[model samples]
Target: MVDGISFAIGRGEFCGILGPNGAGKTTTLKMLVGNAPPSAGKLWVMGFSIPAQARAMRRKIGIVPQSDNLDPDFSVVENLAVYGRYFGLSGREVRARIPELLKLAALEDKADARISQLSGGMKRRLSIVRALINRPELLILDEPTTGLDPQIRQNLWKLLRHLQKEGLTIILTTHYMDEAERLCQRIILMDHGRVLADQSPQALIRDSIESHVLEVHGSDLDHWVGEAPVPERIRCERIGESLFFYGERLDCLVASLDEWNGLNYAYRPANLEDVFLKLTGRELRDG
Candidate 1:
């Protein structure tokens, strides 16, 4: 259901697409790989037109799907060999790339293990490496770290950054605001099948939200708006039990915390999540 969304990515860039459920993130990824052809519009990848030169375009890019579809029957190394052949590599050529990919994924010892025996993080790491079997210039990841634990997610984040340093253009879709903010040099925010904002995280935070956020918890916090200091720049919004005050100057706001001594409050810089919630909303989204 995506409508008229367009943007171009340069080589060696790390970009992220952020959105709520049913925002056409997956559909857009599918079209890039030519799995779902665009009904109307020109689609190009690596200097080749999609669906017309899909075969050629695919050769220049790799995809890491949300799910780890590794065959439980195959050993980790065997998986790479099999996928390499899909790119028309000779058996010898595939074998030569195994050591390099395994080293990149830090799976040298686990190479002989059965896919079923690998941990969630290991499996995810393997999926990323499998996508690299073809040595693609561009790597597309769809919610790659959705269910991983924090530690594993951090590891994967480091891995992705390392890959980016190696000069690969990486495009990822993520629901984790911190992930997008930390990993992507640029972010494309989408909702309701359209692009809402496309810019760097810093830029988005600066433009879409105030510089700081003061969060307080209480049952009836809306009545406390007049109690905030320097109320001119502050914009207040209540979500559930917490009331957030956004503004450019927070010194006065921070001092106001003493007035409500018993109630709990925290103040920090505004982030991408704040901007996203401000732009889209704090409501639930059902597909």
Candidate 2:
């Protein structure tokens, strides 16, 4: 259902596609990998027309889907060996590359470990290296760190950064704003089957939203706002129990918080999440 979506990722670029649930992010990815053909419009990857040259195109690309589908019956080494054969690799070739791939994933010690013995993070890393069995020029990751803990996610980020530095073109789709901001050189923001914005996280924050944000939440927030109204220059929105204030400066707003007892507040620079909410709205979106 993606409509009017047009963009190109250059060689060795680390780009992120971000959106809420059911925002056509999955649909766009399906078309990119040739799993679902686009009904209209020209599509090409590395000079190969999509769906028409999909087979050849696929040979040059590696994909790490959102969910881990690693075979539980096989050990880490066995799993890699089996997947390598899918790319027409011989046993000897697969065996030769296993050490390097295992090293790349930081799982050299777990080479013979069963899939059931691995942690969620270990499985995710294995999934990544599994896709790299062919040493693809382009890597596509769909929500790579969705369920991992913060430390594990950071480790995955380090691996992805290393891959990019090694000259691999990577396309990552994620819902975590901070992940996209930190890892992606450029970000494509999509919603409701269409593209809303495309820019670097810094550019999106600087150009599309206020410079600063003040988040105030606590009891009797209404009474405080009634007693001392937000300055006209500052934009304000009340969502549930919190009041969000956006503007170039929130010094006055922060100072005002002291007068209200039991009110908690935080003042900080605007970020990718702010831009996303401002564009997509603050309301909850259900899948």
If scored against the real structure, what TM-score would every candidate get?
0.96, 0.98
- List of clashing residue pairs for candidate 1: none
Please list all clashing residue pairs in model 2, or write none if there are none.
none
The lDDT of each candidate is: 0.90, 0.92
lDDT of 1: 0.90
Error of 2 at 19 (Å): 0.6
RMSD of each: 1.5, 1.0
What is the TM-score of candidate 2?
A: 0.98
- Residues 20-100, candidate 1: write the lDDT tens digits: 998889998999999998998998888999889999889889999999999888999999999999999999999999999
Superposed model 1: Cα runs more than 4 Å off: 219-230
Task: Estimate, for each residue in 167-243, the C-alpha lDDT of model 2 and write its tens digit.
Answer: 99999999999999999999999998899999989999999999999998998788788876578877888888898
